[model samples]
Every structure is written in C-alpha cells, then in structure tokens.
Target: MTAPVDIERARFNMIEQQIRPWDVLDLDVLGLLNEVKREEFVPPAHKALAFVDMEIPLLPDTDEALKNGHCMLPPKVEARLLQDLAPKAHEKVLEVGAGSGYMAALLASRAQRVITLELHPELARMARENLQQAGIRNVEVREADGSKGLAAEGPFDAILLSGSVHEVPQALLQQLKVGGRLAAIVGDLPVMRATFVTRTGEAGWETRQPWDIAAPRLAGFPEASRFHF
Candidate 1:
C-alpha cells in the first residue's frame, strides 16, 4: 500500500520532471495540477500510474479499454493543452472527450462552465460520478458524439479535443465564437501535431501547430478514405 507522502512525492516529481520539461510553464496550470487529485479519477487498479507520463487506460477490463476510447492523456499533454488554451474565469469551455472527467475538472477550475461530451454511455456515467466525487460542480457530461460540436451550446469560448483526430471537423469549427480558440491533436499515427485554431472573423480563422505528440484517435470522427488512382 502506498502512503500519503509517497503519492505526494510522485505527484511533485511528475510536475517537476514530466510537465515542466514539456514547457508547461503557466503557474496557474501548474498549481491546478497539484490541487486536483488525478489518482481519484484514475481506475483503482491503475492508481499507481496516475502521475506517469503516458496514457493510462481508464477501463479496468483491458479488452474493452482503448476500443472504447477510455484513456487519460499523459499528464504533461493535458497540462500543456490547458496552458495554451488559457481558459478564463468567465469563459464557457467545451471538451470533446470525457474519459475520466479529469480534463473537464481541470477546465472547470479555470472556466465559468464546461460541457464535456462522451460517446460511450458507460464512460459518460463514470465521468459524471467521478466529477461528483471530486466535488466539481460546473462541469456537465453529455453522452453524445462529439464529432460535430454541440450546436445548441454554440459559440463556446474555447474548445478542446481530448484526443487526436485526422483533421479538425468543420462542424466543430463552426461552433466556435469569433475569437474563440480550439485546441486539438491532428494527424495520423506515429506523428501528430497539437494545433490551435482561432476564429479571427466571420469567415476567417487562424491555425498554429505548436508541438507534436501522438494520441489515440477520438471516436466518431470521420476517417480519410482510400482512393485508387
């Protein structure tokens, strides 16, 4: 059994070694990383991997795990995305994947309100329960496909794709408010870039690729088709 001090030390080491080295230098984001108990949102059997710098499967049953898109992004990736997005206190945020509700909880800590969408019913239910247990009140988990952003909750201040995508869906881009930012990891396996898109005007948008990292493809997103020449 792990002691409290051991867990705390591991958490500290994660921040100092994994997160900070990744250039996640935002003080607020760093502080929130410490404040939120990641271990609580992780599966009990994988609690020891809570601070590891790799994707941790959310489902206890390995066979149904990655297939369901139930996995937490590496701690550093989560922190870097949050820092880059810089969600404000008065902003409304949207998260595409709610694996364990951990990212939603992080966004909720900075934003006024957060709505996270999950495709799997069981995962959504678990996310809700985890958020409730964490005492996170401003996050709402919806069981729905996030390929197209939530239309009724349009004009979100910021949007986040908690997983990777072959390309950013136009439907989601249309949901962002002018000046709103959308962060997503885009590209195929072995090589993916973390990109940010900002709505500049009614018909204009700006995109940037700040870093490269690979993550599992978000479920329900359209896949590129093969064509014979």
Candidate 2:
C-alpha cells in the first residue's frame, strides 16, 4: 500500500512531468492539481494508483465499457482540461461528468455555481457526498445523461465534459450562453484531441483543438441526430 505521503508526492511529479510539458500554464490550476487529494475520491481498492498515468476504474468491469461507467481519466489530462476551462468566479457552470466529483470540486473552487451531471446513479450519489465532505457548496451533482445535457437550469456561462464524445452535441451547444465555451475530447480511441468550442455570438461557434488526449466516450450520447451525423 502506498502511503498517503508517497501518493501526494507522486501526484506532484505527475503534474510536473505530464501536465506542465503539455503547456498547462495556469499557476492556480497547477496548484490545485497538487492540492486536491485525488485518492480521497477513488475507491479504496484502487487508491494506490490515483497518481499513476493509467485510468482508474470507477465502476465494475463489464463486457461493455460504455455501460459500465468505470473509467476515471488520468490525472494529467484531467488537470489540463480543467485549466483550459479557466472557470471564473460566480459563473454558472455545467459539467457533463461528475466522475468522483473531483473535477466538479476543482471547478467549485473557481466558479460560482456548477451543475454536474452524471449518468450513473451511484457515481452521482458518491459525488454529492464527496462534495459535501470537501465542504464545497457551489456544485450540485445530479444523476443525468451527459448527452441529453441539462435542461431547465441551463444557459450556462461555461460547460465542460469530463469524458469524450465523437462529436459535440447540438443541444449542448444550444445550451451555452453566447460567448460560453465547451470542452471535450472528440475522436476515436488510441488517438483523440481535446477540443474547445466557443460560442462566438448567437449564431456562431468556433472550434479549436486545445490538446491531444484519449478519454472514454461518454455513455448515453446519441449519434449526431442526422444532420451532423
């Protein structure tokens, strides 16, 4: 068993080696990566690998990965994407995956309000508890499909997905307030680029490739609904 002290040092090393070279330049983000105790959110059985470069399984291993909802993104990729979002104080944010509520907790430190949607009910509950334990009140963890996105309480200032998608969901794009940004890894396995799409104006969305990454595709997202399919 890796001692908590060792695990923390490894996390710092992971940030210096994997994230800094990836061009994540924000000092606050780099500091948060080291400050947040990721192992606290990971299942006890797998806590030892929290700082390792491999994905940590959050759900039971299943024949179909999409159905299992088990994969937690590597620490470096998670930190870099969070840095890209650059959440502002008091901004209403929407996050598509709650994973372990770790990402939402990070966003909570920077944003005013965060509504994080998680497809798995267990994960959602776990996220809620973790957020409370961490004393972060700015985030709301709910059980919902990321693809369907959040309805009713939207028009978000910034939206982020903790998983990948083959393409951006139009409904999600519609949910973003003008000038709001959305980030997700969009592409096939073994190779995918983290993409950031910003709503330039009411009718314009400009896409930019922020970084190269590999993340599991979010479950429940439909195939592009015909036009963009």
Candidate 3:
C-alpha cells in the first residue's frame, strides 16, 4: 500500500535540510553531495533509510564489523569533513575506510586520484562496483588495514580517515606531502571532534579542530586507538 519512494527528491532534501543545517554550506561540497547518490551506495535493504540522519547497515554479519553493528555516519558529517579537506584539482587523496565508497566517490569528483584502504574485502569489492557504476575513474579501492597506513602509496596530497580515531597515528602524519592536509574525526562517541592536520614542514604538522562530532571507529590504527586495558 505504501507508495514507491522518490529517490531524487529525497537526495535533494537530505542535502538542503539535514546536511546543510549542520554547517555544511560550501557550494562545491554541496554540489558533490548532490551529485553523489548516497542511496545508491547503500545495501539494497537499507536503501530506504539512506537519507535518514543515522548510520545504515551495509552487510548482515559476514564480518567482524557486522557483529558490532557499526554503520555509516550521517550525510551531513561526511559533507562537513569533505569541505574541511578541500581537496584540489589533480591531487592524490588517500582514504582509510572505503565503507560504501561514498567518500571515495566524493574525493574522485575533486581529486586526480584516490587510493582508498578497506579492512573488509566484501566492502572493498562493493565499493569498487559502486565506483564503477558511478563512473568514478579516479578511485582505487584496496583491502588493507589502515593502522599501518598505506606505506607503498606514500607522500599523498590529501589523506582522509573515514572514521573516528582517539588519536591519529604518528605514521599517518608522516605520509602526507609537506603541504597536504589530513582530515579525520578524533575522539570517542558523544564528544569527538573532526580535525585537519596540514603538514607544515619536516617534523611539524599544523592541526585544526573543527567539529565536535562522532563517527564509527576506524578498523585499524591501534597505535592511535585507545587502550582497552
């Protein structure tokens, strides 16, 4: 009896109402949000809740993350962080968690190339498919633990951590170009803040704390992660 949903209007409202009110008003960033369909990246079952202001499940428990019920963050948060990253034309951007490939797609729209890391192989494969479907040619999805960072793809122009960290790994800081910026949400739930660290020079990185928000924890990065003991 329910009507078939209108996906395009939902995407428009999601951008104008939920994400924009969260202080994500940059035209370029907003345009990217409009261009990328979050619903398309969502799993078939969760497609309906794609525009909702909460996390959505990607898989049903074939992985460790599914056992934990850790879903993707709200669209507004992604928009805000992407705005802070400010990736430029012809720059290489690195993303730690591929998730649904939403962030990677966003980066592909602005950057020359995106080297993204993913812990879950299923997620990585799905992301690759989504990117292909979306016609995003610049994103390369890989299966790897982000705790180690991407050593082989070092010296990137921009780095983005797809989830929150209690503290960013010192190793990740070393991977950026002298002028590149790394954007990530840092801290625990209910009080985390998104930060941007710009590599000012050798042995020095300028940091900025922008948003006091919360996102799912990055799978790897035990060095920057909190102590269980």
Candidate 4:
C-alpha cells in the first residue's frame, strides 16, 4: 500500500507534469484537481493507477466485448476538458457519462449545479457514493441514457460529454442556453477531435475542433451508418 504522502506527491506530479503540459493552465481548475482526491474515485483494484496518464477502468472486470466500457478519462483529458469548458461559479452544467463521478465532482466545484447522467445503474450508484464521500453537494448522478441530453432540467450554461461520441447529437445542443458551450470528442477510432460547440443565438451555433484525443464511446449514442458502395 502506498503511503498518504506518496499519493499526494503523485497527484502533484500529475498536475505539474501530465495536466499542465496539456495546456490546462487554469489555476482554479488545477487547485480543484488537487482538492479532489482522485484515488478515492478510482476502483480499489486499480487505485495504483489513480494519477497515471491513462484511462482508469471503473469496473473490477470490464468485458472486452462491451461496446461502452466504464472507465475514467485520463487525468490530462479530464483537466483539459474542464479548462476548455470553463464552467463558471454561477453556471449550471450538464455532464454525460458519470463513470465514477470524479468529473462531476470537478464540475460541481466550479459550477452552481451539475446534473450527470450514467447508463449503468451500478456506476451511477458508485458515482453518487463517491461524490458524497468527497463532500460534493451540487452534483446529481442519474441513471439514464445521456446521448439525448436531459431536456426537462436543462437549458444549462455548459454541457460536457465525458466520453467520445461519433457525433454530437442535435438534441444536446438544443439543451444549451443561448450562450452556453458544449464540449465533446467526436470521431471514430484511430482519430478523434475534441470539439466545442457554442450556442450563438436562438438557432445559431459555432463549432471549433481544438485538439485530437480518443475515448470509449458513450453507450447508446448513434453510430454513423456505413456505406458499401
């Protein structure tokens, strides 16, 4: 078992080395990264990988054949997404794919309130437990398919897809307030871009692809149709 001091050192190194190098320079975001104990959110079986620069599986045994495996995004990816989205203290945020609720915890620290949706019931329960243990009170973890976004409680200031999607569904964009921003990773395997969609007007939106990174697809999202012509 690693000592507490060692775990703290690893978390510091993760922020200074892995996350900072990826352009996540927001001081508040960095501070929140340190405030939240990532190891607690990580599965006990993989606790050693809490600060490692790779995705950490949330489940003890994830089926390889599963279409949407439950896992936490790499520390850098999560940090970068947070920095890019820039959730404000008074803003309401919506997060899709609450694996361990670590990301939701981060968002809740910055936003007024956060509503995260998870497809797996066990994962959803785990997320709620983790957030509660972490003393995060502004985030809610709901077990549901989040591909379509939560409309009834939406019109949020910011939205984030914690996992990759083949395409950002129009329904999600519509849930964003007129000036809200949404961040998502869009594309197929081998190549994917981190995209930001900002609602400019009642029906106008602008998109920008800032970087490339791949993540497991969020379950229940639509897959692009293949053409064999």
Give the TM-scores of the predictions, in the order they appear: 0.97, 0.90, 0.91, 0.96
Clashing pairs in 4: none
Candidate 1 global TM-score: 0.97
lDDT by residue for model 3 (16-123), tens: 899889988789998877678787798887888988887776787535554342457788888888888989998999999888898899988999999998888888
Candidate 1's residue-wise lDDT over 136-186, tens digit each? 999999999999889998989999999999999999999999999999999
lDDT tens digits, residues 93-205, model 4? 99999999999999999999999999999899999999999889999999999998899998999999998999999999999999999999999999999999999999999
Worst 10 residues of 1 by lDDT: 60-69
Encode model 2's per-residue lDDT on 73-190: one tens digit a residue: 8887887888887789969999998988888988888899999999888889888988888788889988888887786998988999898887888999999989898988888766
| Cα lDDT over the full model 2 | 0.82
Best by TM-score: 1
- What is the RMSD, in Å, between candidate 2 and the native fold over all Cα? 3.1
Better of 3 and 4 by TM-score: 4
Q: Name the best candidate (by lDDT).
A: 1
Clashes of each: 0, 0, 1, 0
What is the lDDT, from 0 to 100, of the residue 161 in candidate 3? 91
Of the candidates numbered 2 and 4, which has the greater lDDT value?
4
Model 1 residue runs over 4 Å out of place are 1-3
For model 3, give the RMSD to the true fold: 3.3
Q: What is the lDDT of candidate 3?
A: 0.84
